[model samples]
Target: MDEKVLLGHGSGGTMMRRIIDEVFFDAYGGEELAAGNDAADLPLPAEGERLAYSTDSFVVTPHFFPGGDIGHLAVCGTVNDVATSGAAPKYLSCGFILEEGFPMEDLKRICQSMADVAKEAGVRIVTGDTKVVNRGHGDGVYINTSGVGFIPAGRVLGGQYCKPGDKVLVSGTLGDHGITIMSCREELSFRADLKSDAAPLNHLIAEVLEAAPHTRCFRDPTRGGLASTLNELAEQSGVDMVVDEMNVPVKDAVRGACEMLGYDVFQVANEGKMVCVVPAEESELALEAMRANEYGTDAAIIGEVLPCPDDRSPRVSIRTGFGSMRILDMLVGEQLPRIC
Candidate 1:
């Protein structure tokens, strides 16, 4: 019960749970972080294989958006996470928190959207739960989705597997989701027609893995976007990385909006884009596989990993088109709230 809590330490034991209950619950009567799990395989009765599991909660302000809704996002987010571990997502459980007096028609629409996207992704919603909160208590609706998938035999992928000479590839243009959400908000309304890139990447990932069997890892840049994701990878692999600014695919509208609003495009959130790190030799194979997918037509190989001396700390830097380099640091604080 006397354990110290860090920023990213998920509560899986009594210590962090105690802290949440004591501090958070005492203040709000809710312990949100009492339990959580990362995207990793869970041990099961099966011997030669394992199942990858991941869970996510969606509370996007605008229940509906240009490209997707909360229900669609809930499924894609969790599915993508499980897939990053080289698993073929199969089943999902959805839980909905609906506000009293919420429109049944909208609820029905969101549910249908979930079904459509789920079917498209080749996954099933096996079970679900629903609860209604007081009229003013809940925001229209919130969804939590948990998924599991079976990892193929003899397949292992993770950031820790990255090494020098690995190539970095992005599924498509960045910041569309974050910027789209921003443009949709009524409070700070902006004129843009960007759509949320919230789509299941399981199939695309499957193809990439098939083509590039030696891939180091796959990461969907969500809340903290590509910069944070790459920083975490660099630290995990203990290697340096050099990303070319011009090589990264950021849509013109997104780039312009970020420039005008003073936001780092690299730090913008993405719901449907994935970051892939593979061996230099098979990088093209990975690129080809990604480009073949509908969601990854704009995929590009943006950078390469470099050796980091034992005495020097690993770093991620970006090479500008103007012949200069600057450190690409991880996002420090919340850039946008409830972005995913």
Candidate 2:
């Protein structure tokens, strides 16, 4: 590891994992922290009660984008993390670090956006804190959100729970959020309409869980995108994954943007999408449930888990559009920075 942290350490790829394992985890190792799920599952004070808790910070540049803004990202990110554990997100705490002299009007708008999203997700922002940093010491605004949710009885989910015969599914198209941010950041113009796919997925997740109670795992392909996310799940579950390229949805506009920018759609961020692993028999039910939600209309079964090969090393392989297979590894470095 390097003596100083680099942006790659936060890229949610190999470097990030190394830092977590060698630095943070080394210093703060524990059963809860070591589990390495999107959120921490904790035993509640009341018997038979369990809670999922997670925290996330947003530093997206521009703050405002096509379909959503930083405030929306902050609320949805934390809410999705808690909900990924099969919990119903209930409450959130927000903390803001504002640059001195920042415009008050923009701040108000951001807060209202957060309020609206929280209400939509059926979660409440019950607590928060505010801090002002020197004019040059901070971005326009940065938001940190911590959320807690109640887990249903006898419901268990995590990457490690995935089995060889489980099916893999994604809620909708990949890379919309990442490409939208890139185009906005670089001020690129395109004939095709481009927008961020940023939305809260708690409601959609609830529906899927209701229909596919045997869901083995749930993950939001955010920072490092679907490739890193699926790789993590495969390694954790000690299984292999074979994904079909044609089945992984990608909008024409997003594909065009990626081609123009040399971005790999599989490795781009998506704020409003999720990957669900469930028993093969229940895949149809899961897909049907997801499609019933607005956020998951393009839902599809993209892949299937396979037993590890002779070497017993977990791996992810994608069948390319050209009908060739290739291993998908984590991104070597950050492709787009300051992207939520």
Who wins the TM-score comparison?
A: 2
Candidate 1 global CA lDDT score: 0.83
With a 3 Å backbone cut-off (N, CA, C), the pairs that clash in candidate 2 are none
1-340: candidate 2 lDDT, tens digit per residue: 5543344544558876775566434433355557766655654545665889999999999899999999999999999999999888987877777776666557667777887888799987655555657667888789999999988778899989989989999999999999989988888886238888899999999999989989998999999999999999999988999999999999998998889889999999999999999999999999999999999999999999999987758999999889999999987799999889
Tens digits of per-residue lDDT, candidate 1, 244-321, equal 999999988888889888899999999999999999999999999999999999999999999988998999999999
- Score every model by TM-score: 0.85, 0.86
Least well predicted 10-residue stretch by lDDT in candidate 1:
26-35
Which runs of model 1 end up more than 4 angstroms from their true locations?
Answer: 1-47, 186-192
Name the lDDT value of residue 162 in candidate 2.
89
On lDDT, the candidate that comes out on top is 2
Per-residue error for 104 in candidate 2, Å, reads 0.4
lDDT of 2: 0.86
